[model samples]
Target: MASENQIVVLDGATARTGTGCMHGISWFVAKLGSTLAGLAADLDASLPSTLMTSIQAVADQHRATCDLLHPGTPSAVVALLRLNETVLEYLVLGDVTVIIDTADGLQVVADDRVDRTARAEREEADRYPFGSAEKQAALLRMKHAELAARNTPGGYWVAAADPTAARYAITGKIPLDTIRRVAVLTDGAARLVALFKLMDWPDVLELLDQHGPTELIRRVRAFEAADPSCMRWARNKRSDDATAVYAV
Candidate 1:
């Protein structure tokens, strides 16, 4: 749900969609955090400013569509927060989740990726590789994208039918004094919370403290490497597009 066409922080928030969208507009904004790793194409820096531009673009498009049709609007969109910047802010659409780090430790700030449709798709795809090698051979036994598409949803939200569109934001932030270090990972990595019996932010933060974010990312990658080609699409708890952003 991140809208990052270009990089840099903006100084203002403007509504680009809807009538009177200004008064109640939820413009993306947040206090910038430390150690940023954003994904413009591969990645970038700054959270608040970058997202403002992104959300504005989406809103503008939505307004334009609405203009074309009587009150037409595109799906709500969420912008990615720049990791470290002068301010902190982000936008979201769908269900991509954003976690923030505070003195109490880590906590969820926003969610904007996946949905019921996406979940069902993940479950069916889980039976295959990308999760387990058996999955590939099993899928190979099938036939084409049509069959696999049937296994999941239309492949729009769940299946990686398209990689370019598959990339998305899982966590974003500008964790200030409340947190010392933080980690932003896609829902796939967070899935370890239940499957592996790990705790939420605090618990994760504890583990992160002991092992360090570098090690944390390394472990996650190890799991990814072990999986078959279907790893990115594994239906298991932690098998969608995998990404992790850690910082203090």
Candidate 2:
């Protein structure tokens, strides 16, 4: 949901194994969004400084609702942004991304450390057919490596049940007047540019300016529909859940 001049995008992680209640991720995201909104009202504290407290509040809510600890339950990546008259503040956790429309051009901010760790396995999986046993084995290997790297030093971080992950978030502030607009996107919606290379960031900005966020998602889904087996894309899911928020 878009708040005031803020854009928040949250995507629930695909369950690794059994189908349990992934409600925790949504709950965490909602609480986190609210916390950040509340914190944004006070410009006295920097975004990075307030991050830990915001994360802890969400973690506490998660524990109270799901009764699960870090690395135990499902998690989600988050992309949050606030644009005021003076400054544009942004925070990115996990693989979600923020695209800012700057006076010079479009600037993209994304956390891809998770992708760096799984490249080899992803390539190996792509070597075999989609449903082949070899492909499955390779994918499994990739998933294991990714899991091991999560929330650790030298590894990627996400907004899991872990409060400490707040420290891993990428955050900063830019001159508000320099930014024309901003888009907060989950990995699912960002596949068009990141995974598929269907368009560059500038092209994405053009799309957003013309048709809006829904058009961008529709374009990605259309591409996926044409390549249902992911034959051309070589992805984990044929179609992933996607979400985006645009603030102008």
Candidate 3:
């Protein structure tokens, strides 16, 4: 979602088989994204404050029909950039990446607490072959561990039923004059560097400069197709929802 002054990208979580929400992940992300964008447009609030209000608003819409406290309930990682006259205000929560091409160099803002949590279980899951029953069992254990850590102190935070998670988002301002370009990417699109080791951040920015955002995502899909079994680049899913927004 983008407008004259703001850009918003949301990566909705993959719905679990038994998510306690009455709505799907798509519904959650669509509502949350629109609400956040609307609030940001109408209110003179900070990025995090607008996000908090949006989450609370969405929760109010579904609270009576769904189990809001369930860990598996609908959630999303957020990447937001608001352009001001002299500065750019940005917010990142969960794994979404916001890359800034500035006069000094490239700056990346992302939250990695999810990777820091459930270490043992994730390692165990990695030990088993992908698509095997053993791997599935290990992944289940990892999921449970992740659920236990979600939104807790020292754990990762995402945009979910808890409005307070907005407080944990990475937020800051960068001088607008120093920025040459900006790219906001969901984790799926970032897998090119973060997971596949295909390129560095500079390389990614260069790619975006030369080819554009669609080509970046196309390359990611090509790589995933080449390694369909996850043998070369191990991952939880073969293909994820990839999205990218580039601004100059």
Best by TM-score: 3
Whole-model Cα lDDT per candidate?
A: 0.39, 0.75, 0.89
Model 3: number of backbone collisions: 0
Among all windows of 10 consecutive residues in model 1, the one with the lowest summed lDDT is 28-37
The numbered model that scores best in lDDT is 3
- Whichever of 2 and 3 has more lDDT, that candidate is 3
- Output the lDDT of residue 22, model 1: 28
Candidate 3: tens digits of C-alpha lDDT, residues 1-248: 99999999999876534678888899999999999999988536899999999999999999999999887988899988998778899999999899999999899998888999999998888776677888788888888888788888989999999999999999999999999999988999999999998798889888998999999999999999998777688777788999989889
Candidate 2 local lDDT, 1-248, one digit each (tens): 67676666667666554323346455656777778667766767765556667777766654554645534366677776776569888888888888888898778899888888877887887777666778778878877777778888988887666667878789888898788878777888888889899788878877888999899999989998888767788888778888877777
Give the deviation of candidate 3 from the true structure as CA RMSD. Answer: 1.2
Task: Determine which window of 10 residues in candidate 2 has minimal summed lDDT.
Answer: 16-25
Global lDDT of model 3: 0.89
Residue 70 of model 2, lDDT score: 37
TM-score of structure candidate 2 = 0.86
lDDT, residue 197, candidate 1: 40
Candidate 3 error regions (>4 Å): none
lDDT tens per residue, model 1, 29-107: 2211101123343335333334334444444433533332212112222324443434344433233344556666446
